[model samples]
Target: MKKVIVISAHPDDEVLGAGGTILKHSAQGDQVFWLITTNITEPDGFTVEMVSERQEEIKEVEKILGIQKTYLLNYPTMKLDSRIVNEMVPRISEIFKEVEPEIIYCLNRSDAHSDHRYTFDAVMSCTKSFRYSYLKQVLLYECISETEFAPALPEKVFLPNYYVDISNFIEKKLEAMNIYASELGEHPFPRSERNIKALATYRGAIAGVEYAEAFQLIKFIDKE
Candidate 1:
């Protein structure tokens, strides 16, 4: 069984980004782990601790995805700087030793969100420098909030090279996101049914798949 890890700066990212891949890999009996890099309990204008509320969202997601093992870095959300990742070098070095993942997925470095970019850099640095990190390739995936047009999708579009048909797992993704009832506060869009389905269909057409999940291929393994 291969060892796989998902690193997300935000909570719901694992599902929105590559939930199908995660499910497919796990169904193959691969050992899966999550490296959640933030504790984003508090938001600026929100009255409740969005961070703490996020834990429940995560729990509900775990039920659908069945990733029993997880790790949270507990660094404050968006507080990570280059210096902090440097400080985390040794800590990540230890995880590298422990997990020794053969394949890895993480946030895209060019994401619009600062936290996603920070986490992406941290994973890249860790993979490059860690003694045990001889990973063949590291793929990049898009989180919901981060992938919505703007800077994340230059030209107001995302062109993905790889797509996993998640039509089967799409319902689970929606179910997982539903657990975040607290954080879905005041969403301009209903968010329950339309956007995600539209994105999956849109990306599927581009990738020539039916009901797909999209990811930006930053690096790839040469199966040769």
Candidate 2:
């Protein structure tokens, strides 16, 4: 079975970004791993109850998604920009060595959240072909709120060039995302379930599928 990894800045991002695709991978017998770059903590103004709830949510998501394992860097939430890449890269690289994933799905570099951007940078640093020969493909998945809210600069636009049909898995993806009750909101709020399904429908139109997840192809190495 092929090994796959999904790296996210926070817990709900994997669900928001590529939950359906991950489900597809697991159903196809690919071993899937999750790398969460940040966490909510008491030091970050979150209450003890809030911190505990988020941990529970992560566990629920792992079970629902069939994640083989989860690696949490536990970096301070929303403060990734303040951290040094030097300190981040080695820890992430170690996970790369252990997982040796053939396919990686990570947050878009130009996403609105600084944490997302920084996480992408660190993950990319670990994917150099010379160092991680097992890595065959790397793709950036778009998080609904973060990606759409990014500054509308030409360079920052999320131009999706790849699509994964997720018609059968969309409901399960929504089920997994609902575990993060604190993250979702009503219709107008970007993380709402309605909006999430809408985005999938919109992307499906682009790809001629009933429902799909869109991604930006960053790298693909063919050794054959």
Compared with the true structure, all predictions reach lDDT values of 0.72, 0.93
Residues 48-146 of candidate 1 have per-residue lDDT tens digits of 655556777777777677685788787887788888887666776677678887778888776677878778777877766245435666788866666
TM-scores of the candidates are: 0.83, 0.98
Q: Which ten residues in a row have the lowest lDDT in candidate 2?
A: 78-87
The candidate that wins on TM-score is 2
lDDT of 2: 0.93
TM-score of predicted model 1?
0.83
